[model samples]
Target: MNKLINRLVLGSALCGFYAGLSNAAVLEVQGEIRPDPSNPGGAQIINNTPVTGYCTEFPGMCGMLNLRSNTFNISFHSSGSIPVGHVIPFGFPATWRTFTVSHSSIPGETAEIQIRIAGVGTRYRLSQKAQEIVGLPIGMDEFYYHTTLWGASWVEATPPCRPATEWGRGADANGTDFTVFWLTPEDVTTCPKSPRYVIPGMSLQRLDVHYELRAVRPEKLIGGNYQGSYTYSMGSDFDMGSLNASDPSMTFNLNLTVKQDVKVEMSADRVYLAPKSGWMEWITHGRKPEKLLGDLRFFILSSSPFKMDLNCERPGIDTCLISNGSHQVPVDIGVSLPSPWVDDTGQPIARRPLKLGGAGLQNIKPAGLPNHLPSLLHFAVPQDSVKDMQSGSSYRGTVYITFDSDI
Candidate 1:
C-alpha cells in the first residue's frame, strides 16, 4: 500500500526601489508608480510642483491641465527680464513648438512633450498714447478689457490666441489677469510683426507653463527607474515668447520610477499529498493508485511583467526528487493563475509546468492589475514512479518558488 507522504511549503523575496536626479536651476519633474488596491490603472502621474503664475489668476486653465489623468504640471516661478542693451524688440517668437525628450537611463528611447496651455504676466506699456491707440476695432473688446492700444480687446475670439482655435490649444487670455495676455501657439505668419510687437517698453513679469506628456506606456517597458530631459529656448519659441529676456532657456528633467509590486500570500503554505480521492480504496481493496496529488492555495498581486523560479532540496536530471529513510521518488509541480493574468503572448497559465530555472514563468503581464487574486500551486507524483515506492514509506522535500519582476 503506497502512503500519501509529501508536504510542500512557501516563501518570497522583493527586489525594487525608486530613484531621481538633482540639479540647481534645472527644473526637475518627478513621478512614481506604487502598489495601490484602489487604483486600477497601470501608473498614476502626480503633480509635485506648485502652479504659481497660472493657478492663481487662471483657475480655469489650471483646472484644465489637471482634468486629464496623464497631464502633469510644473512651475517656472522666475520671470523673463527684458535685456537693457538690445534696442529693437524682436518678433514675439512662434509661441508653440514640439519638444523631444530622451530618456537618461534607458538608451534609444524618447517621448514627445507638448505645451497644452500657457500664461504670462507683463506690463504692456507704450511710449506714447493718443487717438492712434484707438485703431483696434471697438467690437473686439468682448471678454476682457484690453487696456493698451496695440491689442485692444484680446477677449474677442479670433485670428490667434483665442481659446477655441484647433491648433491654438484652448490657450487664450484677455488683459484682465493683471496685465497678462494668455495665448497658445502661433508663428510669425498668423500673429505677424503687426500691433502685437509694436510696443515700446514692456517687461515680462511672470510666465506659467503646462505640458501634456506622451510617455512610453508602463506596460510596454520593463520595471525600473527611468529618466529624461528637455531644454527649451525662452526666446520667440513655444515655451516663453520673450525675444529679448534675461533668462535664455530652461530645462525640464523628468524622473519616473516603478518598484514592480509583486506579492504572494499563501492561504495554505503546507500541503499533504494523497491519491485522487483518498487512501481508502488503495488500502482496503489493494488497488494501485492512478496518481498522487496535492495543491497549495495563494493570493498574488504583480504590478508588472514577472517570472517565477523553481528550486529543490534533492535535484534530478530534469525534475526534483523526494526521499524517505530508504526509498526515493520524483515529484512534479505546476501552477495556475486566474483571469487578467496571462503569459507574454496573452495565454492563460493553467497547469503550466514549473521548471527548475524559471522556464515556465517568464515575461507575463496582466490585462488588469492582479489584486490578491486566488491562485494555486500544484504538486503531483506520477503513477509510474509511485508503483516503485515502498508501501507505508513517508517521503519529504521542499520546493522554493520565486516571483521576480526585474526581468
Candidate 2:
C-alpha cells in the first residue's frame, strides 16, 4: 500500500511540471508601423524587441500581432515639380504634365487602416490684375488640377477622383474632392479584409501622390507673373486608442510665371582678317579666291520681330584701301548672308540676308526667322574689283553689328 501511494504522488508531480513548461511564453511578438528612412515616401514594419529564441508551440504567433489598433502616423518627406524651363504650349492636354507627391506612414498596431486624401482649391488662377490685362473671359479658369493613386501601375480612381478629372477650386473639401489608395500587406491572408496593415511595434510604408496640372485656356495666359495656392489633408481611419496626436495634413501653393524675353550673342568679340598670302591673288589664274575675313557666327533667341544692322565706323570706309603714302589700291567689299537655319523639329525658316553694297547702315530684317536662329556672315573682296589696285600696303577698318528687338 505504501509503494502504490509513492508512485501515484510521483505521477501527479510530473504532470504539473509538463503543464507549467507548456504555458511559459518564450518569444514576445512586438512591432509597429513607421516611415522607412531609406526609401522616400515609403513605410516598413519594424520589430520593437529583437526576435530571439525558438517557439515550441503556436510558432507562427511568435512574430505576429493578434489585434487591430491605430498606432501609426503619416507625414510627407519629399515633393517634386515638373521639369524646369518646361514651356506649356497653348491647347496642351492634361496628359502632358505631371507632378509627383510622396509621403510615408508609421503603424503601431497590426491591423489594416484606410487612407484618404482631401484638398482645398483645385482650380488656381492668376492675379486679378493679370486677368484683366490678359482679357481673360468671364469665369475663365487658368489651370485644372487632378490626382490619382500611384501604384506599380497607376490605378485610376473611380468617379469624383477619376484620372484627369479636374479638382475644382474651393475651401470646403472632402473625400469627394480627393482620392483613396490601399497599402496592403505582402501576405494578404494575414490581414484579410483590412485596408492597410502593419506588423506589431513600428512598421513603415511609403506611398506616392500623383498630381497633374493642365492649362484650361492657355491662349488667355498672358506673359507676366502668376500664382495660386492649395491645401491637402491626409487622413487615416485607424483606431488610436489613447495617444493624443494631430492628424497629418499639408498645404501646397501652386504658381507659375511667364516672361517674354530674347537673347542674342555673337561668337567672337573681334574678327581678324586672313594674311595677305591667304587672300585671292590674280596670279592664281584658275583657283577661286579665299575670303579675306572669317564668317561671323550669330546665335539668336527671340519671341518677337528683330533686326540686325552692320555699319562702318567711319563714313565712306566701306572699301578697304591700302596706301603707301603716295598711291592707293582699292579692294571692293562683298557681304554674303547666311542661309535660313533649320530647327530641330524640321521647320524651315528664312533669315533675311542683307544685300552687299558700299558701307552704310546695312539694315537686315530677318522676317520668318525662327527662335534660336543660327546665322553666319561672310566677307570677301572681288578679285576683279581689286585687280587694278597696287599691293604692299597696310589697311585697317571697323564694322559694328547691332541687334534690336521689335517687340
Candidate 3:
C-alpha cells in the first residue's frame, strides 16, 4: 500500500480567476507517498512552485501567467517613446518633473506590476541649482509597477558622466558601474537578505514618476498603438525595457522622463590640527559656508563658520617639556576639526565653509621642552575628512604656526 503526507504550498492561480468567472480555485496538493509496488521503496511526491508559463494571445502578441487557460493569459513588455530634445545636465536643487507614461497588455487583460530603470549614469540633487553635481553615469529606469498605491511616482535616472560628450552609434553604452533595482518599500523593508546590488553612490535622489494603465486587445488592433510618450533627453547612453523583462530582450522608448545629472552633498564630522610652537593665528581661506578641498579658492581657514581648532599635544605620563625661565620652551601642538565637503563632477567640493573661528587656537607657547637638535610635529587629521573625497585634493587646510620670544 502507498501512503502520502501533506506539505504546505500556496499557488497563485491568477489564470483561473480570469476565465469567464466559472472559477476553479488553484488548489495545492501536497504529500509524500510510498512508491507503487513495482517501483519498490521510493515514494513520489506532488510539488508546486509558482506556476509560470507564456501565452501568445494572438500572432506576434505574447503574455505570461502564473497558471494557464484557453481565453486568458497574462504578460507584459516595456516600451516607451522619447520626445526629441537635448539631455539636460542633471544638477542640484533641480526637480525631475513627474511625467506620465502608459503601458498596456496584450489581449485586453489586467496585469498587476511595478517599474524600474537601469543604465550607466550619474545621480543628482534637487536642492542646489547652478552647482555642478559630481557622480558617475548610470542610466536608471523607474519602478512604479510594484507600488500598491501609485502616489507621486518618480524614478531618478543616473548616468555616468555629466558632459556625456560621447554619443553615437558605436560609442560604449555601459551606463553606471552598478545595477539599480527599483523596489517598493516592501522590497527594501520586507526582504530578509541584504542587497547584493550597490546603488553606486552614497547620495541618491528621488524622482516623481507617474503611471497610467490602458487595456487593449492585440487581435482587434493590427498596429501596436503605444499607450503614451515621455520626454527624455536625446543621447546614445539610454537603455529602456519592460520592468522585469529578460536582459537580452530590452526595449527602447523614444522620449523618456527628463534626464538630468546629479549632485552629492557631504559634511565633515571631525577635524584635527598640528601646530608648532610660536606659530599663532593659522589664517585659513576658502569658499564661504563650505570650504572644499579642490575649490579653486580652496585654502585653510577661510571665513566664518568654517572653524579650525588648536589643541595642545596630549602629554604622556611625566612627559611635559620644561621651559627655561627667560625663554619659554617651544613645543608643537596638534590641531583637529570635523572635515566636510560635497562632490562636484567627481571632484571634492566644499559644502560647509572651513572657518578659523572654532576653538581659536592657532599657536601655543609650551612652558618648556627638552633641548633638541631636529624635531618634527607628529599628528593625524580626522579620517572622515579623507573618506569619500576625490584624489589629488587636500581635505585639511594649512595652518601657519609662529613662536614668540619673551620681549
Better by TM-score, candidate 3 or 1: 1
Q: TM-score order of candidates, best first?
A: 1, 2, 3
Q: Which residue runs of candidate 2 sit more than 4 Å off their true CA positions?
A: 1-260, 274-293, 302-304, 317-374, 388-390
Q: Estimate each model's TM-score.
A: 0.54, 0.27, 0.14
lDDT of 2 at 12: 7
Worst lDDT run of 10 residues, candidate 3, spans 12-21
Tens-digit per-residue lDDT, 1-407, candidate 3: 11111111100000000000001112221221112222222223222222221121211211211112111111112133111221222222112223333324324412111222211222222221111112222242222210111121122223221111111111112221111222222111111111122222222221211112121211111111223332332122122211121222222132111111111111221222222221132224321221111111112221011112321222222111112222211222232222231111222222322222322332211112212122222222223422333433222222222211110
Worst 10 residues of 1 by lDDT: 12-21
lDDT of 1 by residue, 1-407 (tens): 00111234421110111111023225567665443323344444455554454355546654664421111222222233233232323233334445655545546644443333333223233333322243445445322223343343333322354432122222224322233333434433233222433444343333444544433344434455556666655543433344444555556677755555555566754567777767786778786847778777776644456677766777765566777747667778888988778887789999988888868577666766555578888777788987887775677666666676655
Model 1 / residue 30 / CA error / Å? 6.1
At residue 139, candidate 3 shows an lDDT of 42
lDDT per residue (tens digit) for residues 1-407 in model 2: 00000000000001100000001211222333332212322333333433222221222432242212111123222122212222211110112222322111212211122122221011111112222333345344322111111111112322232322213422113211222222222121111111111111111121222222333322122233233333333422221122112434433333333222234455554444442464445345533444343445656443222333434433234433433345443333333333343222333334333322412222232323333445555444445534443455544444444443221
List runs of model 1 lying over 4 Å from the truth: 1-32, 35-38, 42-221, 227-255, 287-289, 368-373
lDDT of 1 at 95: 42
If ranked by lDDT, best first, what sequence of candidates would result?
1, 2, 3
User: What C-alpha lDDT values do all the predictions have?
Assistant: 0.50, 0.28, 0.20
